[model samples]
Target: MAMAVAAGCGGGSDSGDGDTVKIGLLASLSGTYEAVGTEQRKGFELYLDTHDNKLGGQKVELSVGDEGDGPPTAVPAATKLVKKDKVDVLTGIVANGSYKAVLPLVEQAKIPLVSSNGRPEVKNVDRLWHTAFLSDEPGAAIAEHVKEEVDGPVYAIGPDYQGGYDELRGFTETFKKAGGKLANPDGKTKWTPFPKTTNFMPYFADIAKSGAKAVYCFYAGKAAIDFAKQYAQSDVADLPLYTAFVTEGSVLPAQGKAAKGIYSVLNYSADLDNEANRKFVADWSAKHDTPPTTYAMASYDAASVLDKAIAEASKGGKEVTPDTINKAIDGLGKIESPRGSWEFGKTHSPVQKWYLRQVRPDGKQLANVMVQDLATLGD
Candidate 1:
């Protein structure tokens, strides 16, 4: 496909030298996480559409790469974006592995890398901004809740990857600190399926017989869908299920009835009470024919960050360059986000609110209803 070019003029628009701020988006457009990648892209596009496709008075161009779900494909795609496409800025990662692979290139180029979705294990990097939550924050938040609510051991499971391992560590460490014990402290109950796992019956059977009070899991995209459906159909369906990133946004639309009553932790919810969230939900639905997912929310926030930085960089008719944009973001304080107001922390990841939500019916659609706002639970 051709590069997505948004041309318009106003305020500090790209004018002299025929400059355009090209944003390179890396996502798994055709892999298991396609739903997630699509939602993120939609969110960024929605922001541009509402702003008439202009950032800081300059026109914007989005170049996309189908980075699949891992780094082997992602590194090359990101390399092409930076080396050949010569994009001015980079964003829109959907997986941790892909983010790790492409980060060195961005750091070497000194181009601002705004991560829209991937929540890597590392924190604090120069010229890199994480508009999304870290991989561990939601897991830690859930662990805190699990400690207070669940009376017995909490079992854990995740896909076997960097994201999975990071999320588990987040939950386990925090849960232990809160005096919670693992179902199998020897790590016997912890399960890690291959990345492309579709059949979850075997795992569910193990979980059913594991004699755990509740289960803590980290799964996203297609894997999340399959696991939720299989768990709901299994004998252990009645047990309390808690997870991070498993029951929100694009995952829910596909999960449908199986998603009901699942307690999850996230920064944004469809039913989060706030003016910004209310307006964002309505606007996104009107444009996309669906409610905005957390992935979408992150992408929208990334776009907003870019818009603010670009506007600052273009001040006094100054040419917008990578260095200028980086400086603008570095100086940025709190961003008024749809999830809520948040600011970049010392680690460049968002220090934002974490909501404990339960999936329930809201009229004809399933929505994540906020149980409580566990405010600002990130590094």
Candidate 2:
């Protein structure tokens, strides 16, 4: 994997005393989750750019490393950031697998690790908090929507991994609870080779044979792009597709017309009617020339949370140490985010509204438009 380091030195004050707060970010800069990592990095960096790269009136330095696709590479990267770079805190993990690999070292160092994309609720480790959506949250919300709106058999498909299991399980359990049934419970409801498969035609063929009225799916990055395009060209293209993280933001731009009319439940939407989101999209568009994705919003929120915590810690004229930062974050009741106002749950995941969105034309470009305000689902 490749590693890149960028210090936010120019915008913030050059106190020149070596007192810059170092924030280590571990993300997939290459491999399967690179697009996710790129957007996440931009979101975090955008916050710094807008704020003049200062947090709590202190200069901030960001040290970034590619976590690749798994823990083998991430563990060493995290270790280097903590032991060698002596970073004050850690943030930005794209894959849950990477999070699992590097978490032990983070706990040992006792530094606060704020997750931007990693599923935080799944791991019970201390010194870690999630500023991103729980992996199953969007699934649960979609389940609730399906139970209330759709009828007949519902089928599910996802990359065969722990996250895929969690996503599908989250949907199935809630859908059953709300009185929905699977098309084939005992018959291959789950599938695999998550980061391995590129061609999903076989999966789509199986979905067609399942005789389900609706289908729920979860795929991101290149896989998501291919699935949307291929699904649109498939026999079941007209079937109402309900999904979580299956469409929106980065993926939506690529999916384009193929993604039109697809419904999804997620925490952040570019079309959200709120002051914070309006400003976020406007500023993000001005800076990146692209609409912000949920991944970006998550990392952006991570930065916001860190800024608030650091500012709170500075009230006493104290340096923003790990403990002080954590305490400050703990004291915070709610964060006004681009997604909306949300509070960190007991599990460190955000308890926020899950928006039901549909891919549709938004004047010049295709985008995920808010269809309805779905239920809040998180730990």
Candidate 3:
């Protein structure tokens, strides 16, 4: 909803005469996914403000697009960011749906666009990439820990989108591999149109009839907490819960007691003790009014990687082209992220360990309990 614009043309040039390297932040600034976009934008802006809006001595100009207004609307915003604004890099496309809709423009222009968070695999089409997530990689993490102690009547639920399908597939594939059977048919993956069906009782009714001992799902932002409440109030209240990409600072507060026994497989758990995470969490809490989400943490890392690449490239006297930037990213190899040590995989996604977490009401505040040390799946 907020557009902050800057022209880096007059800034001092450390990267040779400082051609203002413009970066585009495309996301659903307004729509069903606006909550995610606002958080992502805040995270990106926080990094810029921390760095004084400079990357490699080149003024970083951010042009944000509202991708949720629909694909037709997104195309024009993409054009303005790419052609009119003349940005050097693209950094966001909030949800998996918007990312998928906007790829062609970035790919055609051969621009290196990073993401603010875990973008779906379908979002990538060669030059268009995200450092924050690995689609095939996360499948194993979700399956790895959930498979350990859960089995019998394992029900899966998610929206009928690619992201939903992917999460369901990742959890189910790993569950079955771990000797767990899908309480419902393998074909019952589709959940239906989202944002329209606010009441999840009917869905719960179906899952209850299926007789699942455990339930796993992938829902982000407000929808995640919505499902958590529904899951808690479901007739199958006795079932243990296993879900990936849940239990964050943002979602946990809304989830309240409904999330007491729910387990999550994620890249970052707020209670992590590592020095990097401790510092990140502390610094973030001090800086922002709201607690940072998993996406916010990943967005910070993405900015760090991009800024590192630009600085390294400038030091080597290389022009800041998309190809050169991507090469630097590919060569970044291993990084000490807030989550832990992560490296770029063959699929151009981050290969990192997933943490197993449990939600517990700590003194009237639900906090994530870091349980398993780590779990990972792909190359």
lDDT of 1 by residue, 318-364 (tens): 87888888889988898998898999988888988888999899889
TM-score of 1: 0.94
Alpha carbon deviation, residue 318, candidate 3 (Å): 4.5
Report, for every candidate in turn, its global Cα lDDT versus the true structure: 0.82, 0.79, 0.69
Better of 2 and 3 by TM-score: 2
- Please provide, for model 3 over 208-276, each residue's C-alpha lDDT reduced to its tens digit, 9 standing for 90 to 100: 888777787777766787788887888977788777665665667777789888888778777777887
State candidate 2's TM-score.
0.93
Candidates sorted by TM-score, descending order? 1, 2, 3
Instruction: Give per-residue CA lDDT, model 2, range 120-171, as digits (tens).
Output: 3444545678988777777887787797777788888888876677777778
- Backbone clash total, candidate 3: 2
Give the lDDT ranking, best first: 1, 2, 3
Task: Please give the distance, in angstroms, between residue 314's alpha carbon in candidate 2 and its true position after superposition.
Answer: 1.8
- In candidate 3, position 286 carries an lDDT of 83
Ranked by lDDT, the better of candidates 1 and 3 is 1
